[model samples]
Target: MIPYEEIKVPVAGGELAAVRWPAGDPDAPVVVALHGITANALSWGPVARLLAGRVTLVAPDLRGRAGSSGLPGPYGIAAHADDIAALTEALGLDRVVLAGHSMGAFVAVVAAVRHPERFGPLLLVDGGIGFPAPTHLSPDELMTAVIGPAMDRLSMTFADRAAYRAFWQAHPAFAGAWSDEVDAYIQRDLTGGEPAMHSTCRIEAVRTDGIGLFDEEVLSAVRKLPVEATLLWAARGLMDEEQGLYDEKRLAAADLDGTRLEPVAVRDVNHYTVLTGDRGGREIADRLVAYARA
Candidate 1:
């Protein structure tokens, strides 16, 4: 049986929603799985099922994402890291296996470094240490090029759940990778409003948090984490040219001596789907369990 429980965790000066799945025994080692931007705890459903019998899985909706609400400003990597630390402390957990996808990966890396005493290992799925592209274009041009339909999504409203689902179905990001798990994820992230399903994530949070993100200071700090660490990245091109996180050369330069690097060559999987796709989920979860055991 899949042990599922909802938990309210206080962190970073606010309370967040978290789900902990005790895999067979509560005494098993815990793995904290964090989702990427625009995703919530449900993103880990597929992976969680695969590891359900081995490790206790703790998945939390980061502040301002999904059920975790009422957060103040300064919603950057540091803030998210603090939230993780607070959640672990509030739950009385230690020696955890830290894992994250995409933006969530960066958050986990920062948190593990900031609170090295609390975790034993780190597994980064498709992100961490650095991201690609800085986007030298103007803000308007950058938004149009990168965010695409999301710009319209920010202003437009969905008449019903169906409409919202349809919008997601047509989105380029999905690229025919949609599944029941992905569908459920979109549903939970949108709210029914007068004429549309609106996203709960604050637009300002994206603009402010993504701005001025990444630097040598951040990379240096992450390299100092006191635990086993591994990075599982998709071979497909995902990081933009400006982010500096996806470059094979740069990633090689990030070598911290003994950090394991695994390139997931699974078919048709890209940066986004590495953590969101079904096949990728199983692969990531299995690797995470192995990392946790180490």
Candidate 2:
């Protein structure tokens, strides 16, 4: 495993738990990464390893997830965006490469727009663009429908860490893509003692942020990105389904005309693997290196 350090980033109410993979060179570019709604900072482990110390990688467990779970909410995409901006300022970073995956992509979009001067190019992995949701469903129902099992897992109690690992082992998305990095990512989400362990993600935070996926704030932000963004979409979806989240049809409907977003399809990887699997991690790492060097 690549060496990393866990640190706390001071935000409004409390500290956001984060991990840093230091670059070999002190002046190397920095990439500030964000994780999915139910995921923690460790979710970026695979990509961090792939980077091989070429550039500094910093990933935060956004408020209400993992180490930041104690941080009170007002949690939503906008709140998370503001936290990211503050994080950059606190770290003394001018403009850094911004990247997000899943729900994180949404956060990244809002951050870049609200604080455009804080970020360079964006790397959106399988998220950011808003898709239509069923209008009849309530906020909770909408989250259940869109996020599916990930939301369900938030309320579950596990027998042990092994049980939680088994739970994810059964997920279709990780069928053949499981690795040490993936295992480490999931392990970090567990909390409490044996026979009663549960995920560290706060349900309120997930619910609030999940609703923001369809909010106009996110869509408007996507349409107003100040820097160029490369969207890396997976071939498969959250559950390794045939239809991935964003396709040409959905892209055409989003009307990305005035934005600097470019869509790039990544083959043979599902939504989860797009950041965890070797192929996906390498692709993302390559772009990060190029962007960092440029």
Candidate 3:
């Protein structure tokens, strides 16, 4: 079975809950893995398995998501990066290898730039590079066009865990890719009583963090990345769309006149299953292991 300890890292006025998946040896290297805006710490489980003997992965339930959902946030990308910086400092970690998925990548970018000394090479999964700045679009518009049905889940109430899993089962990304890990991940997303279950992620936080992605902090960090980083994009988009969130054209365009951002494409996975799928998660974990050894 996958092994981990749920711990609360002190942040802001309170504490931030995290999934601490240990490495085989006590002396094994460490990496701080951040999940997507609406996701929780457990979302890192699949990938953690592959890095089990090589790296200790600490995945945080960023403020306003899951266990940290109730934390009062002056929420935004800035707050997230600050929280991460605080988490790293509180843990007494040095030369942190910060890996962030989706919106978490954007938060990592801000954190790397905000606290350059503390961060080592970054593994930015599917974000922090592609964007239309907030100056170009409203957060509401960004949310509707980008997150789409995912935002609808905030208002949706599932009658039971199976019902909630049913909702995710219908999602195109998972189509035939669902497994016990995915089931557990989706089931944990539910809250309230058996008769009425809702997502633990606060919609306001999603809205704020979603818009925060387009903010200057992210854009500025992109223009001047503080350290070496890798961008691993999923071949498919959020809805299993033909077009992924970032295509080769946008990636190429992003490269010219900007800091060098290494990019890799993971075939056949969408944003949601990038880490949930075995192939993609193993690939990401292998790279992370290599990063630790380097």
Candidate 4:
């Protein structure tokens, strides 16, 4: 079985929760895993387990989610990056690999660029590099497009935790990905009971924190950092033709100039399963281990 221990590090004015998966030594190369929006550190379990005794793995729940909930802030990418940096300082960690998944990847990129001395390398699982920033849309239109239907889960109060969980299962993103392992992970972050299940995530906090507010700043700084990095994106989900992260022309034009960027595409994974599903996580873990060793 994978071995881990609970760890709490102070960040800003509140404490953030993390799971520390120890390697053979304290001085070993450390890797900090940052989860996405609506997800906590546990989401990295499969990947962390695969690393085993090779490298130390520290996964944080991030502010406004899980044990880090209720921290006051804008919760934007910059804030998340700050909180992460704070956590590192609080724990007295230095020169570690920072790997972030999904939204967390966005934060990781910003953090590595903003605080180059704190991280050795950067690994972005599905999202880290610069992308198109909306120029024609207002804030309201942006929120609507960004949140889409997931906003309902944030705005509505569930009768009980069960109902919320059931609602999540109905989401197209997770239609066929739920299994006993997935269910257990989901159950850990839910509240209420009986007729409904509500997510422990603070919706307003997420909306405010989840938006990408530092695209230009991050992009400008990306070329300055000497951090080795790679991005492993799913073949489907946000990149699918129906709702891609970019238009074909835009995607082709976007590049990580002056930075070492490697791309890996998982054949059949989507946004959600790319981190949670067995095959997807396993593939990521393999890459992470190889990257860390190199």
Once model 4 is optimally superposed onto the true structure by TM-score, how far is the C-alpha of residue 45 displaced, in angstroms?
A: 2.0
C-alpha-based local distance difference test score of model 2: 0.91
Per-residue CA lDDT of model 4 for 38-151, tens digit only, reads: 778887877776676778888887877776776666678888888889888887878777888877888887888778778777878877656544788776566566556655
| lDDT for 261 (candidate 2) | 95
> What's the C-alpha lDDT at position 52 in model 1?
58
- Candidate 1 or 4, higher lDDT? 4
* Candidate 1 residue spans exceeding 4 A from truth: 1-3, 131-152, 237-247, 253-267
Q: What is the lDDT of residue 140 in candidate 2?
A: 87
Candidate 1 has its poorest 10 consecutive residues by lDDT at 237-246
The true-versus-predicted C-alpha distance at residue 115 of model 2, in Å, is 0.7
What is candidate 4's local distance difference test score?
Answer: 0.72
Per-model TM against the reference? 0.85, 0.98, 0.96, 0.86
Q: Candidate 2, clashing residue pairs?
A: none
Q: Rank the candidates by lDDT, best first.
A: 2, 3, 4, 1
- What is the lDDT of every predicted structure here? 0.71, 0.91, 0.84, 0.72
Per-residue lDDT of candidate 1, residues 170-263 (tens digit) = 7655777787777877777787575756876666655544442454545555656777677777656443223323556766666645544343
- Total clashing pairs for each candidate: 13, 0, 0, 12
lDDT of 1: 0.71
Which model, 1 or 2, shows the larger lDDT?
2
Query: Per-residue lDDT for 256 in model 1?
Result: 48
